[model samples]
Target chain A: DQQVKQNSPSLSVQEGRISILNCDYTNSMFDYFLWYKKYPAEGPTFLISISSIKDKNEDGRFTVFLNKSAKHLSLHIVPSQPGDSAVYFCAALGGSQGNLIFGKGTKLSVKP
Target chain B: DAGVTQSPTHLIKTRGQQVTLRCSPKSGHDTVSWYQQALGQGPQFIFQYYEEEERQRGNFPDRFSGHQFPNYSSELNVNALLLGDSALYLCASSYRTGNYGYTFGSGTRLTVV
Candidate 1:
């Protein structure tokens, strides 16, 4: 009964390469999507977000793409740096209370 | 300003004991939400407080309760702690009307033996 799902448990990429993390959601009422990056002993930090109205949103080295018809979204980071290594969580904003439903998370490792 | 502050960064308790965790919201934020994150799992919503009242709640049991002070700070209290209650508790703060996202605290780790 997980509303949001991250199929991949982890991902590895070389520095200067592109890293892609994927997520899926079962609820169609989700109109807003966000990505968060978390480091050890720290809280999740908001990365980027996209409204249902838009198919994509980009910020600096990070880009988020949403496909409403497929109920899927992906986060792309170009020129991945070692500092980018952390856990990534995909969250959806929906439900009656507009609370965020989060995916399990994908740990990203960038090797320099 | 400070983002969100959670107290007693870590705690250990025995079964049947009770525990209380505290949270201070970010500057100018009026809404407080608590979440529980178990091992290898994402954070799950426990409840949310706005204007000193419980505005929304998740599927947690009655053993989990909370309160919000007039200053927008919050406390999460759990009664009759069980071994399963061990997890990292997170507190998030945001504007009353804005639900787009939140600012989260580092979280308090609670261990029930």
Candidate 2:
């Protein structure tokens, strides 16, 4: 069974609009969460992360919100740009190695 | 500084054959981890190497194994490849203390026919 789930497979938004990607997890042991962005034929690059202790973490136009009680998280990109069109992965940080448990990922298409 | 580097950007192998992929960690990083990403799926952890030892592993079969050199470079070996084994193999480097998040390589695209 997958520990992390991104129900939406894709999201489309107009440039300069807001893009929201959501994720959920079944494992309570997950104490930290991260977001990664990937382009074609490239590895995932870390974007932002939030710890279980905080409900939110922000970086530039990207923000990650966590709800520990619901075991859910969301990534928000304000004033989304065309360059943001790519696959976004939601990951939970846990285990002895702190290896990430990733969702299937949601592809965002920001059109001009 | 150079980030994690993986070799053989792409590879092709026959079923039942074996393959080995290599990786060199980022500068000053001492730990290396591998993940497999199938088409349309998230990356799954394979295992991690620290201090030339296998520190942690995922639910992969024994056919999947790895080695970490003293210099923090690593190799992932898979025996008896299957069609399902074809995927983008990613190598990520990090510090043992977890202070630095991982830096990942573009990955090796392996195809089993």
Best by DockQ: 2
Clashing pairs in 1: none
- lDDT tens readout by residue for model 1, B38-87: 99999999999999999888889999999999999999999999999999
Off by over 4 Å in 1: none
Compose the digit string of candidate 2's lDDT tens values, residues B2-109.
888999999999999999999999998999999999999999999999989988888899999999998999999999999999999999999993443888999999
True contacts kept of each: 0.55, 0.66
Q: What is the C-alpha RMSD of each candidate to the true structure, in Å?
A: 0.8, 0.9
Q: How high is the lDDT of residue B4 in model 1?
A: 95
Candidate 2 residues lying further than 4 Å off, grouped into runs, are B97-100
